[model samples]
Target: MSTTETHHALWVAYGASGVVGTIRKSDEGYTVTMAGADAAAGTYPTMEIAKGALHSHMTPGSDWPQFREH
Candidate 1:
């Protein structure tokens, strides 16, 4: 018999208005999706890059917080 473990990596970013965006670990890379968006903004090879992408996608003046594992 063999055992397999699965991991679902997820990170959330919050702002003054509430949930701002999220980064989900995918096979290709980290996928960043902004709030109320119809599709993902983009995908990055690393979490750091993904966070940066999410921040850049945020609207001006939005109070975004550090990404937290969720």
Candidate 2:
């Protein structure tokens, strides 16, 4: 018997006013575009961070920890 697996790719971006952006790959690399801005492109090893950035951007009203210790 044989088995197969599948993986998906994703793209993410954050804008000046906490605008979130995302794109999914049809084959490999992902694409992104911001509000009335030129499209920027890139690739990633995985989709975790890409998704995270989208969430972070959408929830700008929330508080984030600031690091003081080194």
lDDT of each: 0.86, 0.43
Worst-scoring 10-residue span by lDDT in model 1: 59-68
How far off is model 1, as Cα RMSD? 2.0
Segments in model 2 whose C-alpha atoms lie over 4 Å from true places: 1-19, 52-70
Report the Cα lDDT for residue 14, model 2.
Answer: 41
Model 2, residue 67: C-alpha shift (Å): 27
Tens digit per residue, CA lDDT, model 2, 1-70: 9986655544444444543456565455443333344554343334554344334544467443221111
Error of 1 at 42 (Å): 0.7
lDDT by residue (tens digit), candidate 1, 35-64:
899999998999889988898888876665
Question: Residue 47's C-alpha lDDT in candidate 2?
Answer: 52
Clashes found in each candidate (C-alpha, N, C closer than 3 A): 0, 0
In order of appearance, the predictions have TM-scores of: 0.81, 0.33
lDDT of 1 at 70: 82
Return the lDDT, model 2, position 18: 47
